[model samples]
Target: MPAAYQPPVAAMRFLLEHVLDFDAQMAMLPGLEDVTSELAEEVLAQAGRMCTERLAPLNLPGDAAGTRLVDGEVVTAPGFAQAYADYVDSGWPSLAGDPAYGGQGLSRAVQIMLDEMVSAVNVSFGLFPGLTRGAAEALAAHGSEELKSLYLEKLTTGEWCGAMALTEAGAGTDLGLLRTRADPREDGSYSIIGTKIFISSGDQDFGNNIVHLVLARLPDAPAGVKGISLFLVPKFLPSGNGTPGERNAMSVGALEHKMGIHAQPTCVMNYDGATGWLVGEPGRGLNAMFTMMNAERLFVGIQGLGLADAATQAASSYARERLQGRAADGHGPVPIIAHADVRKMLLAGRAFIEPARALAAWTAIRMDVADRHPDPQARAAAHADVALLTPVIKAAFTDLGFETTVLAQQVFGGHGYIREAGIEQYVRDARITQIYEGTNGVQAMDLVARKVTMEGGEPLRRYLALIEADIEHAADHPLVPQLRDALALLADASSVIAAAEGDPDRLGAAATEYLHLFALVSLGWMWLRILAAAPALGDTRTPRGHAALARYFAAYLLPRAGLHAARIAAGPGPVMELDEELL
Candidate 1:
């Protein structure tokens, strides 16, 4: 049997109820009044049970079996289809979807937690719903009414799955240079002819159909990205009454032989004169796709949280049970958990994970407020927070997640590197998160160039102010002073980035470090929030333990903030000065 995952239920509950206060926020939303804390807890408990029982058993097997493309059709690992069916039948897919379209309309925060658990149990399987939710969000926000009626309910209910078709043979991040063609048809649809690479869940056998949200260029369009358009293409073209009718002119050209996530079919999609309807206004595909990309970015961050949490659970469990060298006290051979290095590794995992979970949930809560908050200015501010933090969440969470998993694998020594312990699977799975949904480098550049410097750094200032308020609340703690100093560094770095607008290389050099600084500060803020809320709890052990972890973060992890700030302050001078051909 694979190492069992002990779901961090206590920590999740603490963050959701105490720190994020999602229940209180939900009470104010129009349709979320019914989503009480007790109900949400119950929902999570059931989902956790489903993951442990249904999904956990499939992880190793799925990894071993992988996905196969036979007879020009993609087939998932054994038991995956049934697990997905169970997931949908349980109303899990509709957890945060539109109620008007047969969804439950729960708060997005609930979905965030659910996703974290599901992903921990099975990262490959999680990608199936992850992509669908993104595609559905884009369609719900930008799709025409007719398109909504035809596809939204089905996608929300998991009757149909979805894919984002963006990358091509010659283009990845630079979509402006893509050569895909979308010719206008007399029937108001377009003939989408393109070959898109790195398409997740591009084709699957479980759902009734696959819905694709494709990015392509239309004829008579301008020279660059502004000319691109978004289209809705499906595996099977719909009949007049909305049933799967004729076969669409699209096929999975090949499956990517990837380093990880073997259970998911990452495809090279060939769209040959496929009939597709235009989504949103003409020449505004990026605008429409951002709705999906932003959502996917957050979901991808949660994937990091999931894999890291799983590794933490497995490695810590092993450390407590696996017999190793003698303890420092000269006791007989004991479990490695008694060793200082093992304890440090486990603590580091906790230090990274708990705060990341809080930030992810907090960001999702902001998304809710951005959409449903009563005050206009409050909504705008919440939306800005979402924008500023989205990239940080995506890049930092995945990067830390990959690091945490490797640390966990090291805790197992040689066994961790092999497939038997399952820790290695996480390392492989976590690698992709950094590369997809925009590379971490691209995300950092976006944070510096678009999010931070956009609008003269008002958003960054507002975010720092929130951190200041939290710092004041925890002023008595020893870590407060350090956080305060780091916050200043963040402010200084933002101003520097904003001022160096004319120098692209300088901006590029500082972008990643600035983002890491921002992530550490954000995580520090979350740690403080958790500490503040811990005192109110009846049980003191959780708080006391978390307090220790918070101290560990401060003494060790937070120091990296200063290192990143130093890099940021140095600008791109040293980096740019290096000769291209130097050894």
Candidate 2:
């Protein structure tokens, strides 16, 4: 069925070794001194094996079986529990975690590579650890010493998984509209009462306990978002010895019957006087939760990248084997891969997937630098770069990822639409990435409004400077000038959106387009870097292949930057003119 899923191990190693110089980068960061290229390669290789053997086979079966609520417990898809046990036993969850909390203390770049493999093979299975890692980060950053001592290790080790509970029926994006309540008690804990919807991995039978980071307002709290506070509410309260004791006052009210990721339990969580401890300072819950949300946003982007690569691989395999029309020479029957249109579709997907992988790797390495760089200036610079690119990665990767799946589906024609082919499943799974972790529209607005316009657009200026520097080095390349032009367009668009500070409508109108422009330029910048690194890739065929993809991206994809820039320059009037009741 559409050729068994294979991890892009060679491609990942190519980027890690030649393009990104990952080993040298890791050597610069603290706690990653021993992480070498050879070690990283071995880790990726082993992870690929595990995923191919243990996880890939589970993807379709998991989707078919889906998740169910047995009594009040959310039971995962078949074989998921054993797979998760094997995952934990293999020490994967601790790969990029903090050493103090039983993690292996590796660089996030390595972890991200592994993440891509897992997500590609089995996205439904990936959510379990993905959400737990996010929760651990939040708790590590803001939770009290006691909370950390009690919960951090379990979450880090995947002994007890974690979930984020921020959404309510009335509040999705607007946290201020939430009605969840948290009341303080005498024993330094609070009673959390709320119902959170769309909570991925909210409940699972695989892990010992689920540590839910719930958001609720206290009795004396102020109104709106400022009143909200984050609480660490476990499914089962930890006893005096840090073991699972009495069951907490919470239940999975229902499971969301969704379009995709059916194996992942998207629960409607109900907290009826659940005992919880405050995670951070009063009235600053959003600040704490954002630490997790920001991490999830980037991870979600990688999810898209993983699925995109999977779909491309599937379509390419099918095209190579499925005989169809004649070649240009009018031979008897040739594989569809010979067809110009099919080749174009496949190349387009490759053009996006390769550089997108590089971009994700680069961002992930920067995340490590931002956190662990010894120099304060280096840390601050890396942090700024990560902040500016997060929204772009989240929005663009998912949007294009979904499109890539559809393109892959197109390659198979009617066969792709059939469930038995397994291509349609990729399309369904890829759709949710664009919607969750804040929709792409929300991401676009964040890119234009807060990230671009804030501080007089300093972040955007610095990021563009990095691109310009890369372009300057690749002057001999044909795509150099075009890349420069796209960067300038992006800069100009940023300035236009920044200049419209007083007009909220202008920001809203330009946001999605502006994000698209930013993404194209960013990817173009990545392609330039890839082009420069091609000669050093050490193989004639590989260099030629990367060069072809780079050319395709410049010729076919980068031009969209202009369209988005034009839309951004159009202002908000055309979009705002239509009245709400006109229809």
> By summed lDDT, which 10 consecutive residues of candidate 1 come out lowest?
535-544
The residue-by-residue lDDT of candidate 2 on 325-439, one tens digit each, is 8988889499999999999999989999888888988998999999999999899889888988899999999999999999999999999999989999999999999999899
Q: Predicted candidate 1: what Cα RMSD to the true structure? A: 1.4
Residue pairs clashing in model 1 are: none
Candidate 1 per-residue lDDT, tens place, 21-40, comes to 77888877777777866677
**Model 2 per-residue lDDT at 161:** 93
Residue 386 Cα positional deviation in candidate 2, in Å, after optimal superposition: 0.7
Error of 1 at 46 (Å): 0.7
Residue 579 CA displacement from its true place in model 2, Å: 1.6
**Residue 580, model 2, lDDT:** 79
